[model samples]
Target: MLPLWQLTVAEAAAAMDRGDMSAVDLCEAYLARIGALNDGLGAFLTVSADLARIQAAQADARRAAGERGPLLGIPYALKDLFVTAGLRTTAGSRMLADYVPPYDATVYRRLQVAGAVLLGKLNMDEFAMGSSNEFSAYGAVRNPWDRERVAGGSSGGSAAAVAAGLCAFSLGTDTGGSIRLPASFCGVTGFKPSYGRVSRYGMVAFASSLDQAGTLTRTARDAALVMGAIAGQDPLDATSADKVVEGYAAGLSGRLDGLRVGLAIPEAGDAEQAQLLTDARRILEAAGATVEDVRATADEALIVPTYVVLVTAEASANLARYDGIRYGHHVPGDDLAAMLGAGRGQGFGAEVRRRILMGTYVLASGYQDAYYGQACRVRELVRRRLEATLSPEGGLDLIVGPTTAGPAFPLGAKLTDPVAMYRNDIYTIPANLAGLPAISVPAGFSAGPAGPLPLGLQIVGRRWAEATVLRAADAFQARDDSWRRRPVMATSAASA
Candidate 1:
């Protein structure tokens, strides 16, 4: 039998419903696992043991009182980007290291209302800036598959936590592939909803237009369950869409009959990743879906540069508020302006500073049209092309591709070369740019120098088509059980 800590959110909820285990039992098991593994993994920045216990107790009481919820009593954690009222909400930077939010993010509040237990905050890239977890002020998050490799980021810790069974699920934000990249590296299920599908009122902003709240879970079904709980329009977030939330969990058929799936052939990619894409096509075809090859587009190359420009500009505007006055780390200086510069210089990590500087330059009056404005135009073109390809009248039902160019690389491999590091997000950034729903499902494993590392297959759907994406992912996962294979580190942690 699988240990409680290893169970998926859906599995644990069923177990609790069957009276096979109590909420408290589930919580304690996870806490024990986190305690044993977090020191080595650096997955969690804060483990709210006392608060988790209280939430677990409350969940138990709710279950006893005949109040049933899909997420009731299930343990989860958040990327430190989400502001939790009393819990420390560090955006993986010293700037907000000591800052405690006075209000809860709408997503977290919704999960709490669903009776889920919060274990604490997970680590992330500073201000959600970097492609790898290396930029975190708390120290880099080590991949569970191979300790020396990266877990992927800026949501690396969220993915690592779920992969290591520290939590049944975790909330993460995806701004240019943060959630999906890490999920691919860590071999977990990651789902980034269509922009505005979930409220981002209390989430730390990286890029206002691109950043979206998402989930990292053990399986696609688990993601559906969590999404159903937290996804909806919120008054707090004006950008949140007012569309009716669908019954995502109930809609997962795990059968892709008649679904038109497109295999996005990446441009002369690594051989292993190309094979993974071919393998994914076979699985979908075997499961009764029609598959076709999609030739790479010119706009594909524009994703990274366009994303960098737009996000950095937004980031510059958003981060300007953190100038030693309102909250976060403060450094006293001779005057107000000097103090602001001193505080930001001391508080932000190197990656954050770099992006801020780039953003400021791109948004400057002289370069705005040449860079930022042009990037926005390219972004719109990319979105239009993707929309046409996924349109029901003339195109495919879904698009599939390798989540990353390759598996998790060595920890310091791309640190010095920021371009190489940014390239890591190449395949996963399109959906974010287009404001579409996408998921990264563990497809298979690739042998690494240290050991076997997981590779992911990405499934993308039209805007607001999360149900379709989840169905395809669930069907693929159901057909291929490769996702069931756990890392050796995870196995050792479960036993310990």
Candidate 2:
């Protein structure tokens, strides 16, 4: 059997059920892994050992009482922005570094009800603002595969922690590919459900329209288990779907029979990446699915710009509530304006401030129509284009492509140029814009300057089609086990 630290959520639950291991045992193994790797990797901003032990004990008690569920006794961590009652929920910014929510986020509450243990809060970009984890006020999340490279952004810690065996699985938010991008870099399974598939209540807002709760796990089955636990309607979030949540794990039959897959070769322009997608096409075909290359009618290049304009505009408004009076870092000043300015100026990181300024300018009077308005119109076009192609009558059941343009880059490689950094998400931003379900599965390894870096294959489906998306990914995993690979550094660190 694999070590408890290396067990996937599914494996851990099975082990616990058979009495081979308990939730406490799983918790301790992960805690030890985090203790050994977190300082260098920066995967966790906070480690709640006491809370974890308490939860693990409760989970064991429930299991003893004959409560059987897939997630019961599973240990998982949450992104810092997912507010936890009495636990510091910093959105990776000094502004909220000390703030503790009075209530837990809907997703966290759901996971708790399933008897899952909380490992702690993972680090992220301040206010979930940047493509690279470098924008984090805490510190960049170093890729476990190579400490010198980034683990990817804003959910970098969540992905890193899962890949490094620090947790069974970790919840993250996907706003402009935060979860997918990081999962790709860290070599884990990242699943972003359709918009509104999961409640957003209590999740620190960052482009609320685009922000959706998701998870990073060792495999698609693990992601399915977590999704089944967390995906449901919530009275707290009106945006949450009122529809019934499907049994996600049960849908993973490891077959994609009668499904039509569209391959976006243009998006996978690089020879290596294109070959990976081509291989994926063949794999999907062999799995009882018809695969064919499909070109995008809409210009794919406009995806990033449209996403930036809209998300930044939304972020500018969402972040305005952090004034000193509203419970955040306070800076005293002689006048109200000065006090507010000082508080916000010092509280926000450079990236957050930059985005706020950009958003504010675009939303300014007389410029709204020229920028924000035009961007919204363009966004509608992009969404329509995607919806039309992925609709039931639209010939395609899923779209396959590279999750990112390439593998993880060296830390701070594109930090000086935010545009360059933003472009890294070019392949991923489209799904967010269209409010679709997408999964980034570790597809293959790319030979890098240091060692073999992981590349991810993205499978996107129509909005509210998470089951289909997850099924496709599971089928792919059945053929290729790349998602099961862990970084070498993590192995050595855990052994030490």
Candidate 3:
């Protein structure tokens, strides 16, 4: 018998296509693996074993009846932020622990239409507020490679599950660097489509303008398969692009032989980050790709500060609906005011409360221009600069750099310092700010002064250019078989 736990989505699909594996069988195998491993990792908030089996059986029937899609029968998981009708969709906050959505988000609905079998909901930082996944009310997700290290966040669970072979692939939302960062830490492939390329209608709003949904998978090819099924126009989402959804999977077979790859020269041998970028350039060049030195503009460096303003402002507004009155957590109190205050005060985590306060303060009467408004203008400038540099005449297929400043630090490494945690997103923030397609693929493992940990190289492209990004990523990985290796988690008790 084939080791179902070792199968990739593509491999599983081929098995199902050849009748060697049934969708129901694949789903059951995954559910068994998840059951065996998730308790140790805490990667999931909920497991839909029964539901998944039913969906898988239905997929088998469909395939039997000559119906199939690229992802049909593939068992996947969703970051809890994607609201699923009747399924408990907790955004890893106590506020929504028992709250069930009356409807599915467009992404969930579309995946269902694609005949994808959903295994369950994964954990995330509360309201997608933190980078460590430590802020989740459900507890942090442990890295599959090393249980002692975090799996990264807010999409940590999605990435962890895929990395651990618990799911074929998974969907995660990226605002700031949620998807790509987690994928980097977990040593998986994460693709964040150009903003608006995928519908955010059902995705819980974090930073609306910066929020995007993408896939965390084992390979760039698998990311393309999932992206193909999920990307398109939705009448419900005005922000969703109606542009052509080409065959992203087909584009993966294409090469970067004549393509130009941009290597952003970090200031001097700041050796830490500089070395990671240098290694990335070497891999890309070895794959028959051309490289050019490109400097990150001044606006790019301002992404961290700009993101704070825009994300907090939008989060504050988007989170306003969580008062005790509606569907979320409600505190039974003497009066309406007491109820709302108590519910919000107790339900929201410290980081969430902090951002909400900062957001409200910046958008308040006198501070708008000095803060939020100024941030928007800066964001616009940064976007324009990226567009100019990546235009056809700019001679760049994708921009390459380190995914994070470095690898996963020991737990509590940056917990006390918010700015330290924020700086971790430095290499990733520009993509979200510019509204472009970007991905983080495992480059290789690096041994720093401390110890060895995985490294990631980012490939960013112009808007709606996921194809180019994935192609280059695939090329780099092909040039290095070592990047495809998985981490071996030591024998340790799963974190509760």
Measured against the true structure, the TM-scores of the candidates, in listed sequence, are 0.98, 0.98, 0.95
Please, what is the whole-model Cα lDDT of each candidate in the order they appear? 0.90, 0.89, 0.84
| Candidate 2 per-residue lDDT over residues 93-208, each given as its tens digit | 99987898999899999998999999999999998888779988898999999999999989999999998888889999999899999999999999999999999999999998
Q: Per-residue CA lDDT of candidate 1, range 1-496, in tens? A: 4788878888898888888999999999989988888899999999999999999999999999988888999999999999999889999999987898899999999998999999999999999998789999999999999999999999999999999888999999998899999999999999999999999999998899999999999889999999999999999999999998899999888778888988888777778878888888888988889999886542446988998899889999999999778887899777988899899999998988988999999999899999999999999989988999989875798999888888999999999997788878888888999999999999889999988899999999989999999989988888888778877774464544
lDDT of 3 by residue, 1-496 (tens): 5468567777888888888988988888788778778888999899998899899988999999998688899999999999999899889999997989989998889889999999999999998988878889989888777777778888999989988888889999999899999998888988999999999987888899999999999888888888888899989999999899988878775457887888976553356667777777787777778988889542335878999999899999999999967778889988888889899988898889989999999999999999999999999988888888888977787888778766776667777888777777877888899999999998877663444567777889988887889888887777765446766644212311
- The TM-score of candidate 3 is 0.95
Lowest summed lDDT window (length 10), candidate 3: 487-496
Q: Deviation in angstroms for 192 in model 3? A: 0.2
Off by over 4 Å in 1: 297-300, 490-496
Clashing pairs in 3: 40-494
Best prediction by lDDT: 1
Q: For residue 263, what is the lDDT in candidate 1?
A: 89
Which of candidates 1 and 3 is the stronger one according to TM-score?
1
